[model samples]
Target: MPIWVTEWALIDWFAGPDYPDSARQGEYAEASAAMMEELSIVERYAWFSLPYWDHIPSLGLYHPGPVATPAGEAYARAGG
Candidate 1:
């Protein structure tokens, strides 16, 4: 089964500093996609921008939810 990892801290870390908003977001998506492809375990993966306090901004990862499929089962087994 494939494993899905969501690290909000990592997103915050990467989104910090001199990087342009578009570039940072683009890199985040590209990296996540590449990771999924490399693992060959994920059926789907997604990321979204969210508003943070003081306009800091944040990102979120949403899988197919808690009852989707093999991915859901794996997620549950992994204590998602």
Candidate 2:
């Protein structure tokens, strides 16, 4: 069976034009890219739009049903 993975954009809460410079945004992007590359499932990634007040981007990871691991099994059972 093929494996599937998901990713989300994690933005910096303190990031803003008036705020001091920071690498938080870059770090998030890098981490997300690294995970996708490591899993070799970049296409499976999904990201939700950030709300006006929320800076973090919501992400979801989904794989085939009947997962082998307990966590995956639980997620599948939960219909996630």
Candidate 3:
């Protein structure tokens, strides 16, 4: 028998100036939820690529310290 694993990212890098809004609007979350719902039928799992992706200058990866973003809230509500 064999097992399969996968990972995915939800950021819209090509959104350019609207990247922030794109990330916060739950669009990615909705997509993730839909994918997960489909995967659920197959008993598969999905991993979020990054929880906190912001990189600060000279400070390295930025950790918001357990804060929840609007997208995160929507994701949870979507059963993600």
Candidates' RMSD to native = 9.8, 13.5, 5.8
Candidate 1 C-alpha lDDT tens digits along 1-80: 87654432233444454323433544555554555666777655433332222333222222223122222223233333
Better of 1 and 3 by TM-score: 3
lDDT of 2: 0.36
Kindly give the number of clashing pairs for every candidate.
Answer: 0, 0, 0
The better candidate by lDDT, 1 or 2, is 1
TM match of model 3 to true structure: 0.46
- In model 2, how many backbone clashes occur? 0
**Model 3 C-alpha lDDT per residue in residues 6-66, reported as the tens digit of each score:** 5543445576523335344456656766666666343454444335556411111122675
TM per prediction: 0.37, 0.31, 0.46
- Highest TM-score against the true fold, candidate: 3
User: What Cα-based lDDT does every candidate model obtain?
Assistant: 0.39, 0.36, 0.48
lDDT of 1 at 25: 46
lDDT of 2 at 37: 53
Model 2 per-residue lDDT at 9: 43
Quote the positional error of residue 64 for candidate 2 in Å. Answer: 38
Q: Order of all candidates by TM-score, from best down to worst?
A: 3, 1, 2
Which residue pairs show backbone clashes in model 2? Answer: none
